[model samples]
Target: MIKSGETNSRSFPGITISTDLVITGGGLSGVCCAITAARQGMKVVLVQDRPVLGGNSSSEVRLWILGATSHMGNNNRWAREGGLVDEILVENTWRNPEGNPVIFDMVLLDKVKKEPNITLLLNTAVYAVEKKDAATIRSLKAFCSQNQKEYILTAPLFCDASGDGVVGFLSGAAFRMGAESRDEFDEKFAPSATYGELLGHTLYFYSKDTGKPVTFIPPEFALKDITKIPRFKTFNAKDFGCRLWWVEYGGRLDTVHDTEEIKWELWKVIYGVWDYIKNSGNFPEADTLTLEWVGAIPGKRESRRFEGDYIMRQQDIIEQRTHEDAVAFGGWSVDLHPADGVFSEKPGCNQWHSKGIYQVPYRSLYSRNISNLFLAGRIISASHVAFASTRVMATAAYVSQAVGVAAAICKEERLLPADIIHEGYIGALQQRLLKTGQYIPGLVLEDKQDLVQLATIAASSELVLTGFPGKPLLKPLTLSVAQMLPLPEGAVAPVVFHAEATADTTLQLELRISSKPGNYTPDVTLATRTIPLHPGRNCITLQFDAVLEKAGYAFITFIKNPLVALHFTEKRVTGILSVFNSVNKAVSNYGKQTPPEDIGMEAFEFWCPQRRPEGHNIDLKYQQGIRLFQAESIRNGTDRPAGQPNAWVADWNDPQPALTLTWQQPQLISYIDLVMDTDFDHPMESVLMSHPESVMPFCIRHYRIKDAAGNVLAEKRNNYQTHNRLEFATPVTTDTLIIEVEHPSEQVPAALFAVRCY
Candidate 1:
């Protein structure tokens, strides 16, 4: 190779690329959007400024992704975001149970690389936008610093997922940089100037013990004094990384334009905190610890929020209001951080949780004025109060998945984003998202192409919920514990709880359900019973004498009794879980959420399930068997547990549980999608959190499908994913199909949410 001296200021190489969709940002939102669009047969160009994907979740920032499950802190039962986000999370759990940030990066890269239709541009920043007209985007001019090349990306559709609204800003899309006044949206949760209008940026660091004493020298730039950070005393030797999410600042500054300044401040803070630990004589444990990693960039929280047809407000989240164009859902509390961050003497954050998961409308996904422009990630159309709940990585990803599918619909139909609703394609969009395993609150998949619906189905042994068999394991009722039971709308059955008490005491039993159907929060109490407990083991009968008016989950709550120890079973069912009214400090849940009276937030007790190997079902006996799990339940279309446990669970004793579908005529089938359980209640954070198990305990590990002649159609083993889509090498024509599932483990029973044959 020969090198030539540059004459004048020669331009770097430039190229033009055209695609069906252009998604700006390599964060989870854009990554998921590109993946979804690529899977839907759209050519997608994904642009990122960072070398890696995942943005805040990348190894550079190292923030663990969290969303609706809220670390399983709030009362959101089976509330994990579905679709590609769920797939990514499940894959991460399987591949990197250790939650290594680098491994997580590989997972996102692997997913993007496997999609043939997605052209990912790493280290590319979109600097300019070309508009076809005042309302539509024509193309984006982006430059890749690594290759020193400029790219002109053209697409009919443009989705701006860049965390700070880079594309939207360049396109002149309507946006707001700070919080709106309370009068703007009539939002009571609107923060005052003192509390802060925007959440701040956070920097994280990791420390590891070297087994031998290590010394650290601080730079002159490091903060010399330790007391500068009011919360510095709360720091421990083991606490590191995003666990120090409160190590934040710069909300009072321009979050986008002043990002460099914010990052520098964070760097100074990081080194200062490290220096304090090493030399301040407070942490002796730091003698053997060394900084393994410090974030290269600060994880940004709030910034520019764009405008759409509908701006998500505080009421939509707290009231769980339905949206006609509802395409997504979120359950995380309205979490806002202080503007002063770690420097402020106030608490790090103010959070207000809703009663249940609420729907997100498609109207809020596209720029109101920019016809072809889509808003996603933290930049989506939402008021300050609403953005807090929607800003999390997974929630943003889930919403972006909708944008991806909307792009596909738009491309195929030659329609604009608003036409998705105006032209009556919204239902089609929702159904398409559901086909991809995305769950929208209060919506069920009604696909006419699903052949399983037309077939007559019978199960080998459907679970009649008489009760879980007793185990030797006994858990103290130190806090209120409840068994979540699926019930019918008719006469209620009495239940018996076996318990041992250190002293004779009275046990208070209450039956509760959510006020609204399809919500798991036990906000409405239906019945109560007082039972006597003896010093020795006692079989207490709780006769509620209550009759339900509608079918839903019933919480048989055992009030806190320190003297009583109730039996818990190892038997795990797909949709059934035992919940405790307790605190998960990680998410700042302290049993009950009693927010300030004027915030327009509801107060409710958080009855959340524990993670696997720990969340066992309560051992109890049903006076009358409840047949909620029938073969017909699978065809109802609702996959995950909504207000009800939308699953057909096999009996615990059924050794060879199978569902056989017999059709009147033989039909050819090309593909089949089976929806299994992966413990949607578990958050499955992609980084920094070590899960109890790689595969969800409720996931069916082995399953087989057979045709009329008993020929094996397909067999899956060690399967941990929630969606199992199987395409045949050749079309299989059969009048009868049988699916047999093996229990995931000895503790968990086999369960199926839905079966679709196309």
Candidate 2:
């Protein structure tokens, strides 16, 4: 624990709050710093120049989060970050409803707001840093536009997450920019010598079709033959011209010295080129299509990288080298833009380093000279050549996550970023990462027993009812049956699965999976399917002739089929109305009453066969009526009055109801996997579904889970945040199960598509 005096020292504003550490920049790296520090119970003040979170990927830039994690291997770094980052992903799933950027802003804002230890000052710029001596920074001053005020921050530790390593430069910490000569780092891919010029920036844009088609007109500065460039084959106009070659660095003048001029000229070229393409008869189909996106600001790739304890080089990446302190993974090939401008005949190009993936040492991501600070993201300590490969957002995200964990440890140990890295904290970092759901295929564990156990063991909560042992298999087994059965309404039948032997070395085992439920004794109405299962590894999918619903119940029990798992628990899960409490209220927004016209209910009905409010002392009817009345108010986008309390107007309400009727014994409780029908909030492109505890790191560390009987079933500690769909391997045995949500004190109730439990 930190000394009481130190806590008091950093609490006051304008007092130059001193701490064990300070992180500058609110981008991915800075965000990770605050999250990691907060998890370790450290007080951190995250300063960002913009009003919003997520620098380049934010709606401010409107760039998609590009990375291997978003593409495949749900086990990407975000899964391991497991706290705020995960929350953002979950929220994205909700807001986007379609896995888009609509909810991205909210996700970023929510992450910063939910942390008590993190004081996020938005719309603020760090002007300069105060140095006590040559090595230590005494205070940092920031200008806050909202308050028209200035705040000076002080801390023992500081991280340069500004992408440009602003704090490091200001503090006199050794750093480098541009590509280093091959001989400097002995990296084969590096240029012979280093220069100031580095990879340029890009302005990303996105557009959608309105009811009417829009045409384009060329600007005066348009380049007539941009497409004539040699790299035209790889350039895809439809894909939004993301390839770097499309956005030429500099043709008329030096790009390094004239970035602003270059950016302005490029915009003109972009519009001009689009106009010509749209107007020309060569592409008649694209006439109706116009510029969907025009980036507000350009995304910069290379910048000043802070000097760290260890510098990762291009050789390390190509060799697929492993590090004892490996914290992040990089898979994207190394891409380098030529220093010289691209000519009309041949544009600049990049090369692929390797087909496989490699690990980035955590030591290279923190400051070498600065004792208190740690860095993550693109500004990590790496030569320009190596940064070219690691600069991708996905790789940056993983690096940021690792830094967050390391920063948290620094706070816990009351040490600087430099001290922590040298103290062998890498093992703890790896352990924390795995617990949070991050998949590092090449991650090596320090504990022999733990490493061996993790390698051989396979676990799935879905196998609880079937009695599958949570142990490794020495030899594969398989079982087969020749019976067939049909499935129940909105339900899949239980297939008594077994493990049988296999002769082929590669063929592990065969497990028979029934496609349907049997209604009568030996009613051979459905066909059985076989799936191969690999003991202690691999995802098993049971194939059948029937078109199975992932959202429907996976029957594993016999007495009465209960949902084994909530399939289709994708971004959106469908939910139904169930009432047991009275609720009613008038909803108003901005001190004005919102009419029903503002919010229209497509479906609302009370369906319960025999149950009534008076019977069972349930008051179901009264509760439902109240809920119905308030549901209408939400449609109008109004908030319920402060005095009104009985209504449970869940945000998961939909204009169109899917299933509604009386609750029965074998209740047809089918989920809809609700998705956002449209993007109502402009920037929120979509709402992401997130479990509140998972949205913020501190929530996970301090949260406790309880059963319906008020007994604490489990307490999850450690952060694992991501928005991927959570699949249950086993089904729930209860006839009816109610999921209770306990949100963090600082966070809002997370929006959800549906609550799915079969």
Per-residue lDDT of model 1, residues 254-340, tens digit only: 998898999999889899989988888888978999999988888999999999999999999999999989999998889988899
Models, CA RMSD each? 1.2, 19.8
Using lDDT, give the best candidate's number.
1
* Predicted candidate 2 versus true structure: per-residue lDDT over 541-614, tens digit per residue: 33334444422221121111111111110011111111111111110011111223311111111111111111
Please, what is the whole-model Cα lDDT of each candidate in the order they appear?
0.90, 0.46
- lDDT score for candidate 2 against the true structure: 0.46
Please give the distance, in angstroms, between residue 518's alpha carbon in candidate 2 and its true position after superposition: 42
lDDT of 1 at 445: 89
